[model samples]
Target: MSKPKDYTLLVIDDELQVRRFTEVSLSPHGYEVHSAESGREGIELGTKLNPDAIILDLGLPDMDGLDVLSSLKSWYQGPIIVLSVRDDEDSIVAALDSGAHDYIRKPFHLGELLARLRLALRNNQANQTSPVYTSGNLSVDLSSRRVTVGEREIKLTVTEFELLKVLIRHRGKVLTHNQILTEVWGPKSVEHIQYLRVYVGHLRQKLEADINKPRLILTEPGVGYRLQNLDLLKEGMTASEAALIAEKVD
Candidate 1:
């Protein structure tokens, strides 16, 4: 029942016009807006204020937007929307892949921006309730961005963590190559199935007792992959064998 204006927003942009535009457009609508013209200042402000959300511009005077995003993500846990003139797929994917919740091309429509902000805020709030997910020995804390296996922490790249998160969220359900790709790497990278395979391989290596015979993640045999249900995996068949059985059923 809360409106976006009830929340605080930080805008990291160098262009005075963009900053003013954002302020003028959203201020009357109930948003508590703050602005910074450089990445360094933005990072400092973000760290200090801990706003409900951030709107970041890719082009900045002191540092690249990606750098700022990476730095902020190292500590900040909030919805970050990338607002940039770079509409190229590479830039967009890079931003989203870096940890941005959404990407908006510059010259953006106010309505669309508002809509995306609302959706991101809603998702953020929903995620705040359930931060930790567990499956037997493996545990992932979404809020802390930590993964562990029986008290030992597992190191994972941002991409790998994102991929694992998607799989774990849909445990016991098969997710096709495209579904995983789109969810983790953005829609532009959906055709890059090899990316998914490589990251999955990385996740297996880090989490599995033996990578060759994985006990947790299962390959769908020319289809996709699924995170094994610990209960079912212990009952009778391992996930790998279950996957083989599924292939047979299909």
Candidate 2:
């Protein structure tokens, strides 16, 4: 089996200690780690190295980290995980809304950072290659427009399926109310958060065994919603069985 370090990683933080610590830690794990201390330098290096993944800091010397993120995301197709001290909901939502794959607060655990990076990479790969998404007992065949829960098929209205499709395309990633509404409804409908909520509720009713405590369609509190990508629970489990396990864990 190939080791995890087969990929390249870029660490963009103004703190020399942070860059060094990340390099020392991830280099031992097989990753080719590179560092940049400023937003402009990070953008330049990111454009040049085209690393498989990025660890970005929100506080940069020359420019805001979010701006750098936007610049990199304009062309970079790989995952970008925001690693910063800003743990507030607004900052987190902004980074994710700007196309970040994941967010990690500063003073973070290295183990948790590694786990999030692995998931981001896995999800990125899966998104590119598969038209079918299976998590737990729920299955969505994007190419076929088919959805199933456990052994039984579930029916969805046109609008509801459109909403669900948006969620599936960005599975495991938070979709802001504006993002979801704009995609499923339209740019003009971005303010129609209520519409988005209703459709999401409709989806949960059909997809979740217990709508009161949903496992699949998750609320990201003040941000938006994320479709749970329970990849680990997907092995031979029925929809009902998956729900039961999820309920227990919840």
Candidate 3:
């Protein structure tokens, strides 16, 4: 794909080599690139530059990368691709849940990274139109980051919101535990099935009219979970999540 001309990109990494490599690669391809050597500098540059997108490194010299991600997200809504050497699931999940749009492991291919950057930019532009997704009484305002059921607003933590967003984004589709984990939390967290169970239960208790009989989120036994029958009213939650919700109630 041809690169889009005049698009500004901010690369935030402590390593001089990574910063130089990104600048050299992206500059020739039509991106006006800027570099920052620390989390504080990155945040400041990002705030001042207001780039179209950002490439963030998780392992910063001064502060944790996740903290930078969170702080930047509070003000910057642009697509942020986390570029990091921390390939572990927990780190990836934390970054994603904190609002990183994409996570790319370090030692990445320039071609693949460029492709991801383009895709992120394209998606961000498409999403600006404001799409609202609904299932029964539950509604998710993707643009506003607001969720509600009937007349009541549902309050969710950042992680819970991201988790719910993933499920709602793929409503009516059964996403395996691994798929959902990778989307919301990151790749390494696929084995943390227990975390999924807990969050699903929390969602049920908040959204379902009757927690014991949830009408939205459905379980696929050992497979995964999905929001069932978006265009139609479903009867109840799947057994596992329902069971967990029941436990919460009791």
Judged by lDDT against the true structure, how good is candidate 2? 0.83
State TM-scores per candidate: 0.56, 0.86, 0.56
Over 4 Å off in model 1, which ranges?
A: 1-5, 130-250
- Across 158-183, the per-residue lDDT of candidate 2 in tens digits comes to 99988898988887666788788888
Which candidate number has the best TM-score? Answer: 2
lDDT of 3 by residue, 146-247 (tens): 999889999988988898888766544445677788888888998899998999999888887888876677665555675653333223234443344323
Which scores better on TM-score, 1 or 2? 2
Q: By summed lDDT, which 10 consecutive residues of candidate 1 come out lowest?
A: 241-250
Score residue 159 of candidate 2 by CA lDDT.
Answer: 91
Error of 3 at 195 (Å): 11
lDDT score for candidate 1 against the true structure:
0.78
State the lDDT of candidate 1 residue by residue for 1-250, as single tens digits: 7555688999999999999998998887678999999999999999999998999999999999999999999999888989999987677667766777666677877765665566456556645566686667888998799999998999888888888889765555445676788888888997898878988999989998889777678775555775764544445444454454444223
Count the clashes in each prediction. Answer: 1, 1, 3
